[model samples]
Target: MKVLMIDDNELDLLISRKLISKQVTSLEFTEFTDASQALFYLQELQENEFDIILLDLNMPDMNGWDFLDEYQKLDAHKANVYILTSSLDTRDKLRSREYEVVKGYFDKPLKSNYIAEIINSQQVY
Candidate 1:
């Protein structure tokens, strides 16, 4: 499976990669510390090039929400997006429901069970 992770924090990216790798053996990761850079990368890819997109809501320049706005305009394959955020606010979770491409919302420092679930969900597709 191919995964694109967009997060500003390097530590979080490393941790997420570790957690996800534990669940998926045949995994390919494309990580970005900048949301805009990720978006640009996505533009060049073909359909199904990425199987999943783990996005962080809190970012420096372009937040996850802004990324989603631009992502919606792209005439590219819309990979299933999972919001991996530290925000516990119900409002944020509720807001995520507005995005059709978003598949799930998970907390930071991703749990083992969540990684398993993500892997299983991807298999369904």
Candidate 2:
């Protein structure tokens, strides 16, 4: 499956990718440091191009909230989006509920098992 990861922090991005990779084989990962660029990338792609999108909440160019706002407006595929941020605040988790399409909120570093569940479940369905 294809996974699109959007995060400004290089280390966070690398760690996420590494963890995610361990869970699934043949994972097509597309990462972007800039959320705006990632948004544009999403706009350009066709529906069902990617199966999952792991987004970071705190970004310089465009925050995850703003990305979600703009993302809803664009004619894009309904990919399973998850908020993967470092923020441990419960408020951040609550705020994620505002987005209808968001699958779940996970505080990084994301575990291999968590990602494996998603990958395995998708295969089952």
Candidate achieving the largest TM-score? 1
Best by lDDT: 1
Clashing pairs in 2: none
lDDT of 2 by residue, 73-97 (tens): 8776677788889887889898889
Per-model C-alpha lDDT, please? 0.91, 0.83
- Model 1 TM-score is 0.95
Please give, for residues 1-125, the per-residue lDDT of candidate 1 as tens digits.
88999999999999999877876778999999999999888877775588899999999999999999999888877888999999978899999999999999999889998888888888898
Question: For candidate 2, which ten residues in a row score worst on lDDT?
Answer: 116-125
What is the TM-score of each predicted model, taking all chains together? Answer: 0.95, 0.89
Q: Which stretches of candidate 1 lie over 4 Å from their true place?
A: 46-48
Count clashing residue pairs per candidate: 0, 0
